[model samples]
Target: MTTRTLTPETSNTFTSTIGGYTVRGRAHSLSAWFVLSLRLMMGWAFAYSGLTKLLAAEPFSAGGYLTHVAAANGNPLAGTFAWMGSTPWFVEFANVAVLWGELFIGLGLLVGAFVRLAAFFGAFMMLMFYFGNWSIEHGVINGDFAYMLVFLAVAAFGAGRILGLDTYIENYEVGGRTLVERYPALEYVLG
Candidate 1:
C-alpha cells in the first residue's frame, strides 16, 4: 500500500452531534490505507478460519457447541441456541451456512466485491459469536464485539473503493448507464 502525504485539500474534517454532545474528527488521507489494511486483515482471518474448518479431518458440526457450550455459561440466548442445536434440520443448515458463509464473506472482502453485503454478514456472524462465547468475566465487550464493530466500520467507510474491484464494477457500463446508476439499490451492497 502507498501512503499519500496529507494536504489541506486531502484531509477530511467532520462534526456531528450524538446524545446532546458535539463531536468533531479529522481523517488524514492515509486513513484509507488503514481501512484497506483492515479489510485485508479481516478477509484473511475469516478465509483462513473457514478453510481450516473445511480441511479438518472431522466434519464441521455446531450441534455440540451450540447445545453444550453456547447454552451453558449463563448465556442469555441459551434456550434459543439449545433449541437450534437440538433441531436436526437446523443443525444441518447451520453447518453448511457457517462453513460457506465465512468462505464467501472472506472472498467478497478480499476482492472488494459487494463489500457492504460481506461486511454486513460478517458483522452478523460476529454478533452471533459474541453472544455464543458469552464471556463476561473481563467485561461484556470482547474480541467478537470488536470484530463486529470493525466490520461495521469497514462497510460505513466504503473500504472496497480503495484500489478495490468495486470501483471498476461500480462504473462498468450497463445499458449505457453505470451499474450503480442503473440499479440504485446496488449501492447498499457495492462500495
Candidate 2:
C-alpha cells in the first residue's frame, strides 16, 4: 500500500479547552473537523460490519469457509488458518473477537463516550485487518484504515472540546494517568 503523510497542523480546525474543558477553550479548525469526520466514519464502518456479522455468523465462521480458501486467494495466512483449525473451537472464538471489537468501536465512536478507548481498540483491530491482507501479492486493503488510525491519533489528542467526553475525563486525579492515557501513542486521549 502507498504511504500517506499527515498534513502539518494549520488552521483552527483542531481546538482544545482547559479547566476540565466543557467546551471552555479554543481549538484548531481542520484538526477538529478531521476528528469529527474520523469518528463518524469509523463508527459507521464498524456498525455496518458488526450488523452484518450479527446477521450471518455462518459465512464468517470457520466451518463455513471453503477448505483452502486463503490458498485459493493466494494468501500465505492459509497456513496459519490451517494450523488454527486444529482447535475446533477457535473459529467461534475468532468470530466473537471481531464481532465484539467492531461493536465497541462503533459504539464508542458514535456516542463519543470513552472515545479514546474506542479508538485504541479500533486501531488495534485495523492492525489485525492490515495483517490479514499482508500475505497477498499486490494485496488490497480498506481505504479507510489510515483514516481510522488518524481518528485514533486525534482521539489520542482529545477532541472532546467540541463534542467529546474526553474533555471532562481529562481532569480527574487518575484520569490523566489512566491506562489509556499511559499507552505510549495514546496519551493525548486523556489530554
Candidate 3:
C-alpha cells in the first residue's frame, strides 16, 4: 500500500488489483467538491420528480407500467415485476413508496442528513429502475445503473461530512460524550 498526503490536512490513498494488475493512486482534495455537486444534482432530480408526481391532478399509478411495460421488456426480472404488478396491495404500496421515498431520499441528501440511509434507498430504487427499463440495445450499462453507482459512491465516501448536517449530528452531545462516540454503530449511517 502507498500512502501520501494530498493536502496539508488530509491524505487520500487507494489500491486495487484487477486481473493480477495492481493500481494505486491518491485523490486530490478538490474531489470533495465534485462529490458534493453529485449529491446536490441527484437530490434535485429526485425531489423534482417526486414533487411533480405529488402535485399532479391525477394520482401516480405504477400498476400499468409494472405490468405492461416492465413485464413486456424481456428483462431478467420480468416475472418478479409481473408478480408485484398483479398483487393489488403491493402495487398500491409501491405507488406510495416510490413517490414519498423519492421525496424523502432527496430531502435527506439535500440537507446531508442521514445521507447513507438515503443513498442506500436511492441506489435500490435505481437498481429497480435499471432492471425495469432493461433497454439493452446498446448494452446492460445504462443511466440507472450509473446513478445507482453514484449513490453507492456517495454513501461509501461519507459525502455527508462535506458541509452537511451529519457532521453536527455526529458530534452532538448526549450526556457527556458525542453521539457517535456514545453509539459507534451510527457510523454506518452518519459520517
In order of appearance, the predictions have TM-scores of: 0.90, 0.61, 0.89
Tens-digit lDDT string for candidate 2 (129-149): 554444434446454457556
lDDT of each: 0.90, 0.62, 0.89
lDDT by residue for model 3 over 35-134, one digit each (tens)?
Answer: 8988888888988889999999999998987887776778999998999999999999999999999998898889999999999999999999999899
Candidate 2 residue spans exceeding 4 A from truth: 1-28, 56-69, 134-148, 160-162, 172-191
Q: Which residue runs does candidate 1 get wrong by more than 4 Å?
A: 1-11, 14-24
Candidate 2: worst-modelled 10 consecutive residues by lDDT: 62-71
lDDT of 1 by residue, 73-165 (tens): 899999989998899999999899899889888988999989999999999999989988999999999999999999999998888898788
Q: What is the C-alpha RMSD of each candidate to the true structure, in Å?
A: 4.5, 10.2, 3.6
Candidate 3, superposed: residue stretches over 4 Å from native: 1-10, 14-24
lDDT of 1 at 170: 93
Against the hidden true structure, what lDDT does model 1 obtain? 0.90
